[model samples]
Target: MQKKVPQIVFDSKKPENSGIEILTIESLASRKTEIIDHNPEKAHQVAFHMIVFYTQGESKQLVDFVWHPVKKNTIIHLSKGQINAFQFTKKLKGYILLFTETYLKNQINNSPKNEYLRLFNTHLFSPSIQVPQDSNIIRYFDLFYEEYNNHTEDLNQQNTYKSIYSIIFSKLEGLKQFQPFHLKQSKQVNIFLDFKALLELHFKASRNADFYAEKLNITYKHLNTVCKATVSITAKQFIDQFIVLEAKRLLINSDIKSTELAYSLGFEESTNFVKYFKKHTGFTPNNFKKNYL
Candidate 1:
């Protein structure tokens, strides 16, 4: 059995300081149908981007939107902060390739293709993409996996791997050029995504909508409009969501007491946190912990 992944941590240690862990299709190929029911309560931040090319599968991928009918030859982009879950039977089989965003940064710096750069760099504002199944694109994607696996043992492994990954992203970028659907303007999407980024950084400091708007240099009205346009929620709703999520994560994942957890999240008193959480989530923080954990 594959060992359970250790408690996910966001480590800032340099890459060379900690040897990278690489997973290959040939290694995970036979086990595609296995179910991985666990999810990170809070998505783990990764230095790399994840490209999951599904050749055969029947599963739902939760990205910016939910993707279902996961069949032969589908590709998905998973950027940071997109929480996901998986339920698979014996039919799932695919290649999941991960390499640092630094790889793409290097590509843009060297070759400087506008369309390619735009697609990979969308995470600054939008953090996920779901690509349609395309036969031609699938062929190139398979080549990427084959090329990486076949040349993995080279003396200059990192260099060879880099070349192979570059080729894969270059080919993948072509899909953007000839997409069947008109991809929505990503800038519109980023307004909300960047707001979420702000939430991650400041949820503990303040849960007020005006606080985010001030930092973003936009009026609270504009912030609320942007969030409502994208996610059908108000800015305050999003802020509350983040606070509640963080509250739950700390409550379940740590041994800290409820009152301390409340104080850590910026509540002056534990009772106030309890009242606030109950007002928003309809459950006291303690009850949420008892039921959910």
Candidate 2:
């Protein structure tokens, strides 16, 4: 049987908070005893979005089995359903903000122009952002901390919370241009996101880009163009990466065997899946498991 990656809920909370919780990383690490049947040092998936801004020191954070080296002013965003783990002993100084999707929907500006608010879409942009000393990102974060922790509830303060979060995300999104990949046009990004949604729903049924393109009601060439423009990869390459990513996620988090996972992921024969996995990733499923585990 395949055991699942432990799925943590948005239950970690404080009495004063409603849908959001903000605390220092040091304080978060000290509550290891509060978690039952799970270790914070090991990989597990979360049901809520997370933001960790490193104000000082250095540490490595694990997301989807990949370890990211982080330093001062580095902020990482982890979305719902992504796997992550922390290095509690690394003397990192930061604040972690955890919020549910409902809270985010209320806070986010859904106006079509605000792509930077798409902070958790690791596919379009990198999950981590480096803040400059002169930037107000940290200042706004501090303001939010003070406001949220004030233990006061009123329509006015609630509106202030929304406004502060909006500024923080927009500022962070504006900083994404500093990353290696520049932002794509909104139309291109929207197309890729649509295709991604369909892929996630039907990836087990088909790995071919044509299947998704047809479902998206666009030409295969158009889909390829959209993917290349948005993520710098062909549509087919994107699908393959998604599959391999899912495979790696399962291999490390669950006790499922290689053949079992292959079938579960929709390979006609287990042997073909083995070859496909090795072709894209250097390691066979078992070898990848051994190293990560």
Pairs that collide in candidate 2 are none
Alpha carbon lDDT at 179, candidate 2: 77
Model 2 CA deviation exceeding 4 Å by range: 1-5, 33-35, 89-91, 109-113, 152-160
The weakest ten consecutive residues by lDDT in model 1 span: 1-10
Scored by TM-score, the top model is 2
Q: On residues 1-293, what C-alpha lDDT tens digit does candidate 2 reach at each position?
A: 22546777888556545577778887778887787867777788888999899988888899877798889899889988788898876577888888888888766645344553466787888787887778778888889889887865575876786777778778877778777777745888888888998988998999999999999899999999999888899999999999999998888777898889999999989899999999999889988778666
RMSD (Cα, Å) for all candidates, in order, is 6.1, 2.9
Name model 1 segments beyond 4 Å from true: 1-49, 61-69, 74-76, 80-85, 100-130, 151-160, 163-194, 278-293
Residue-pair clashes per prediction, in order, are 0, 0
Predicted structure 2: clash tally: 0
Q: Please give the CA lDDT of all the candidate structures.
A: 0.59, 0.82
